[model samples]
Target: MTLAPTRIEATPERAPDMRLYESLVARVSRPARYSGGELHSVTKAWDAHEVRVALAYPDLYDLGMANLGLMILYDIVNRRDDALAERVFSPWTDLEALLREHGEPLRSLETRHAVRDFDVLGVTLQYEACYTNVLNLLDLGGIAVRTADRAPEDTIVIAGGSGALSPEPLAPFIDAFVLGEGEEVMREVVDVVRAWKRDREAGGLPRIELHRRLAGVPGVYVPSVYAVDYHEDGRVREVRPLDGAAPGRVTRRVVESLEPPLTKPIVPFMEVVHDRATIEIQRGCTQGCRFCQAGMIYRPTRERSVDEVVRAAGELLDNTGYDELSLMSLSTTDHREIVPMVNALMDAYGDRGLKISIPSTRVDSFSVEVADAVARGKKHTLTLAPEAGSQRLRNTINKLVSEENILTAAENAFSNGWTSVKMYFMVGQPTETDFDVEEIVRVASAVKQIGRQHIGGRARVRVSTSNFIPKAHTPYQWVGQADPATLRRRHQILREGCRRAGVQFTWEEPEKSLLEAVLSRGDRRVAEVIESAWRGGAKFDSWSEHHDWSVWQASFEEHGVDPAFYAYRTRDLWETLPWAHIHGGTEPSYLRGEWMKTLNEEITLDCKRDPCNVCGMQTLDGDCRHKIAELVQMKVDGDSTQKERLMQERERLMMLPVISAP
Candidate 1:
């Protein structure tokens, strides 16, 4: 349903400190960030709504406004009459300093209300770097960073997004974590708050009771309600629910049909990270990349019909007046009818001066064809993510695509109108070596030659490499990441090779990867590390200028928890994973099998064309794409009887016995 715009006014009590706002607005780099006016900004009378949510994105305004998840939840929450949602982004350094100087609490853009006044403060945990920023957001908004310290009057602090998949690191800070899609669960949260507000107004509702009520919500994980025991070896031993009303394992929420994947998102006044209309044509990936957490967490790939896509695109264009539209998906080219969808969009919008872009295109000629069909040889720069440099390493990580595929795709693009091809690569994979790192330059040099042959001297080959950090729910979760010495050595190899080959090379700082690993795989004990680092002046860590490695180093030392234990120590198969209680559609046994496949140099075919090779999505809802391909000529991943027994045993087995270890 298309929601109508409403004007929400700030009550006298909800109004922000105008004097503080006016004084600081002129001093910040972007004065517009402090201003509340924007096109299609919704507002309602503050007291009229039972619950007001200050949806905080723990990043700068420019980046936060571009988040599709933030925008999706913002729209969803505000659509309800009983609840209202407002946008709040972490202030830039200058504004943050000024706010502190003036003793003014952070406020929302719509109602200009102090962030603490909101009934719920829903923060988006999109990245590990945002952990410290979440603490900064809480402290700046007049709320305690720790859940235990927060008073009943404080806004309820809850978080969601990919970072929440393994939420142990931030468990002590957040009141609750939404395990999966927030479309339904966020509304449920608001409903609970609306009822509690009524009960609270009548008298006093115990804070513990309010949290108990929330624990009953599906996919809502109240860390306080669950007990986690750690072994002497620093590994998780068990996680048990306290009341039994809460589930021992919380299943992630998924939307079965992606009918309209959020088309008409809000438009930002100033430039943002991705300034365009976006349509999520598909939801999940079936590529089964061993190191990819998104692939494992979001399964049972669902695609929006081409007709529905066209309709959504048209409506978005008509409503937002945006000229650029991009198709979003885990693997955009793998969509069943991508070429036809691109061609239809181009045909429909060619005369209207539309710019079409697709992200996460596969490293194959078919992707080149789709790009050509959409942009009509007008686009100059084409991007591809090979992930690994060599085909062997690629196969080890289950990257499926070959060196030939990458070269052929570049050839196709160069033959069409692209002058430069940007490639993405990672060095710290599970089974990477010096040879593999050097091969990156070989591939880049080859692509440069192809571009030179096709475009004649205007060819450009640019490569960016970063270290891979193992994440929860992925097959690589049990493995440790590369240490600083190894990571830097690999980066140096790629950099020197690219230099010798005359290819432009860029690489991330090795320390960032180490910190990311610590944050990604950490348990509740690491929560102290996060807070200490933030208190020691660590914010905007994703930015190079603001990154202080010493802060993280100090925090790790203060907590007496070696960062290496979380990031560099390999795990035994039977060892309890910190995120064991967070089930993401697939069985741990299945993940163990996939992890073994990476070691055995075995590859599973894409279920779209070949047999089903069931990855547990079939058990979640239905077979991978039942509506389009309905013959049911699908095959399970393992022996049929074994798969059946494992499926039956999944319920009884809390920690599925790992079949093998790498």
Candidate 2:
């Protein structure tokens, strides 16, 4: 039998003095966002381990705990007897001001120990918007924001995740960036730290020597050992290795298979986003959405077998007692044996009242069956991401889903007891036009009509559109983002169209999206902008209530960096991106080809079901070409006829009339 998980409560013994932290909490808007005392939290004895590492998420506790990467590393590090890992998150604005007033530094939730006191600080760099928060955390921890200003005795700061895959923007702040998955690399790093601590205690070696040793680890990039060069145009020329160190290119690490992550996810005391249990049914995506950085960064799709998924769900249910389990993936329906997997889960736990959720379903009619099986009698909202309104613009970005299919999917969902439907689209994709925007309204109206006809008087249809931001390492990376004025105009058009069509429309602020674009595509020089922003009173930019655009504008001016240069200027395909030093499996040549294809309005077919186009993933893995080839063959043979049938069925489905049920 498996061992029961150890639970740690947040009591006075473990919680820090309220007076010490109260001042910091007062300055932050959300005080509870920082306080750790959530149910199912793990707190190990510090004395039991020689090395203690704090895995920090530079966001709020609620958002941080939901990340799968943090949970995976937490499980892997704590499973070892010699290493102890705890969690920390940036305190909300309310808590931050109170702590600053009292002159108290950031402390860990498990032990309330100063973050600077930990042996190592491993941060998960998930997004570019959190860059300012990273610098703020370092200052709060009493550490120098810049690596050069720190001494050898200071805690080693390391970062990993999708953001680190292109570490150029944050190169100056972090000592070293761990590329790709941390499950395997983290153990090696912890072991190195353990050995170094032992040597320090015994007077066997100097601390600087230990730092050098740690830098030699594979997949670790030490900024101090590399020199950056720039061309007259202010583009990166090269990132050359200093001395006899390894080349500047740091390869990402990938585990052959995924271990059951977060067998015991912390149960928050208060309501938070994604509060339910989550099981990552698969890693990576094969659909190859052209504008998505996640699709590019996390390459070579890998899925947990049905048995592993069911076992994980069972363990999560047994431990956390969560009513719903979300099967997470870039696209859950794309899993090869999705039907069998869902069936196995239902067979094992359906009688026990367990409901499985596929959060990232494809926008097709087949998804209706998957939803029906998992939901049973429970009514839930069905979401479809058509991405664009017009098929011509969709083909330009390689989002090949047709408007007819999306409507058909909605009809199936509404007919099967889904009372509400949500449709997702982006307004500022490459080659998007006023006609495309109008098409979005048309498609949404059609979907609403289908919902009313199928589900009658009790149903509603909602459409959500977000401003598009071009990101690094994707086909659209070189494309410019829509300026605020253009976005606002487009938003107004969408609102008027939706209102006329009697469809509820919601959209993210165009200004926030513009800021995200500035940060996302920014270079190393933009770090100064981030520092300035934080100093000028910018925290939690991800949250609308906390974000201050005025602060960011001032920071850009203070740093002498034009945000428009990064966010609104298109680049040549041959020009170097700021994150060119980090390799995200796929080759630059492949991405360039995809970019050219997009210009010609060519649809690069999905590799999941087509012949290997030599997209560079196979070359990165060296020997995994056979596996990739097999999967490609499976995709081609498995979906060709089905795709043809879907096209015909979609046309027939779209002809249905829209009427209100009385």
**Off by more than 4 A, model 2:** 1-40, 198-212, 627-662
lDDT of 2 by residue, 297-361 (tens): 77677878998888878888888778688989988998988999989988988878887888887
RMSD of 1: 5.7
Which run of 10 residues does model 2 get worst, by summed lDDT? Answer: 653-662
Give all candidates' CA lDDT scores: 0.82, 0.77
Best by lDDT: 1
What would the per-residue lDDT of candidate 1 be over residues 363-424, giving only the tens digit for each residue? 88888888888777587888899998877788778777777788889999998889989999
Clashing pairs in 1: 7-43, 8-43, 8-44
TM-score of each: 0.92, 0.90
